[model samples]
Target: MALAPRHLISLSDLDDGVLDEVLELSARLKRRTGRGELAGKTIGMLFFRGSLRTRASLETAVLQLGGSVVNLTAMSDFWELEEREGSVMDGRAPEHIKDAAAVLSRYVHALAIRPAPLGNSWDVDRRDERIRAWAKYATVPVMNMESSLWHPLQALADVLTLKERLGDPRGKELAITWVHSPTPASPSAVHSLLHAALRFGMRVRLAHPAGFELDGGVLSEAEDLARASGGTLRRELSLEEAVRGARVVYARSWQSLETYGNPTLTASQRSRHIGWRIDEKLLASGQDAYLMHAMPVRRNVEVTDEVLDGPRSLLYEQAANRLPTQMALLVNLLR
Candidate 1:
């Protein structure tokens, strides 16, 4: 990218000013919609993993902005693009990310990429080698739909949900609590949640088991943002304590970093956390907190039907905001 083209690689990629501007733009576009300024623009949508909302929201967002999408999904048209440095081309993968990235940059006005199939290697997974390679080589602006490290699009919707519900996010009591799940999950949503909250100076309480702490680097960033915003960030062991008197309770599940990228160990660790499910009883422990989650949730696993289907649940609104939030972002990049 020349002198830094805009890329939503992570929440940090966009400063608070720009991010909040995007949110405002999203709200405006949602109310009125595009003027078709980007009618002939095309965005390359490459999904190395399966997606429901991200794929649909992005394509729809582009279309709404009068831009089209060239979609690519893994296994169907997606193939392995080697990302390693100076690797021999004798492996099963025939193409390199550099060449593929160059082509993608040339064809589309901008590009959005999802995570590729991750192997058993925890080290490789955390590195996000594939997306990094794409960003390094692609001249066009890159968008991160979701990656092993973060899910910024979901996080943007989350902040939009919070803003829509709470008015101003500044100084609000927000709690991010870990809940039960069928499998170990990525920390993407949680990461973005903290970044968004702290960016706006919201008091953020993070509750999780001993093994389920977030990445240290990401935690440090949240701490810095909180400090800068005059917001407080507390890591609490008690779920009830974390949500106490909070306005919003973000219930989500993430793989334990202690056993991160290790399925067997992650399962073993969460086995002790079966009681961590979020429900009415838990939400009531707080001050009539609004419940939020980036779904499709394992209803009974992460939360009971009552809480998920209840009035406090903001899941659908959050899902709905994904469309406009992405539409604003697409226009920003394409224009």
Candidate 2:
């Protein structure tokens, strides 16, 4: 009998051994060693929202590895999908997700979906219903580009970038500090990075102002993983305290969980934290830390222009690594 196809919905789906293999393969592929591993494969990428880095990187990775791609944008290239179970089809959505997933499976060797949050409450979004439903119905391997709860592909590229810079990441200090943004952002990137960093035995510090805490369930699981790997996890309200003595200072903005799904409330709370921006002086407090951010960052808001363009900034490298790491993942899943 044939085995079931593998799906990468979250970092937790990969244990230590498989995770390490993926990272190692990513490094090898980065050195131009592995090529054409995805020949004769076709990948279908479905995007429910806009993207720059994620779309470009994945398409480049597939083409470079000798594979073809079919890209579709929801509500533009396809119909509005209904995910609710046992619902009447009298609403705006004309088709259900079950039909979509099943049809896509037959057309492609692997299926990848990127579903943004639907302005819903934390309790509803945290279930990650869209991607989970795809995985359940698709016969081919399913990959998560980014969802309401996790960005496993981004986490993979992050770990690969860290491995390339800092040989062995074990016991190294990594500070994931929250910065200010004019608009509310998703916490999926932060949550995935926390999981990946802790799994590699890196001591992580999460710093954010009051009322801007991350999801409690993600924190608890990350803490447990940290403990098992001899890594430590701590929370700091002050940015200075979190960045101090850290090897890597990663800055990003995320919405407050307390006011999530309420735009007006979330905006009012976020406005008060504008003073939390990262600058050179703040970054200097760390122990020669390298700066990192998943980009499309607002200059002078989230971080200063000097800091983002400085020699110590690894933002570009992080973006560049997305290609090779995704190439590695596609090869692993399809072959």
Candidate 3:
């Protein structure tokens, strides 16, 4: 009998050995050593939100691997999706995710979805109901393009970037610091990056304002993974203190979890940390640390131009690695 299809819902779904294999394969593919691994396969992507890197990279990766892609943007290509398990069909969203996932599974070898938080409470959004619903109903392999709680693909590219730059990341210190942003941002990248760094045995320092704490469950799980992988995890209220002597400094912004569901309250809390923006002086605090950020960053808000354009910045390389890492992931999932 054939085995059930594998899914890439979160970094935690991949064990150390499989994670290592994907990264190694990513490097090999980047070196022009692999092609056509995804030949004759089709991937169906449904987006509930907009994307630049995720959309471009995945589409390019599939085409480069000799596979075809079918893209669908919610509310444009189709009706708004109802994510709740059993809701009256009397609302704005016409179709249910169960029906959508099942229908797409018949047309593609794998299904991928990008669903952002619905501006609801963290308690509600953290469950990642939309993607979970799709995964539950889709017979084909499911991939998380991004979700409320995690961006596993971004985490994979980040780890691959670290491996390429640092050789072995086992003992290095990585600081994931929260920078200021006027608008609220999801904590998915932060959560996944923390998980990836910890899994690779890197000492991870998470720095953010008091109200900006990441999900407690994610933190607890990361701590456990760190202990198992010979890594150490710590939290800091001061960005400078967190980046001090670190080998890498990753700057990004996240919504105030304390004010999670309220945009006004979240904005008010974020305003208090405007000084948290990353600059050259802050970057100097690290051990000549390479700067990194998942893109679409607000210039002079989250980070200064000097640091982003600096020679030590790994931002572009991190973004570029997305293609090969995702290609490797698709190959592993489909072929």
| Candidate topping TM-score | 2
lDDT of 2: 0.89
Residue 330 error for model 2, in Å? 0.6
Candidate 3 per-residue lDDT over residues 254-311, each given as its tens digit: 8877888887877777778789988989889899899999877998888888888889
| Tens digits of per-residue lDDT for model 2, 250-333 | 899988889888888888888888999889998998889899988779999999998998988999999999998999888878
Candidate 1 weakest lDDT stretch, 10 residues: 115-124
* Clash counts for all predictions: 0, 0, 0
- C-alpha-based local distance difference test score of model 1: 0.85
Q: Rank the candidates by lDDT, best first.
A: 2, 3, 1
Candidates 1 and 2: which is better by lDDT? 2
Q: How many backbone clashes does candidate 3 have?
A: 0
- The reply for model 1, stretches above 4 Å from the true place, is 1-4, 117-123
For model 2, the stretches where C-alpha displacement exceeds 4 angstroms are none
- The C-alpha lDDT values of all candidates are 0.85, 0.89, 0.89
lDDT of 1 by residue, 168-249 (tens): 9899999899998876468887888898888888989999988888888888888888888899999955788887799999
How much is the lDDT of residue 27 in candidate 1? 87
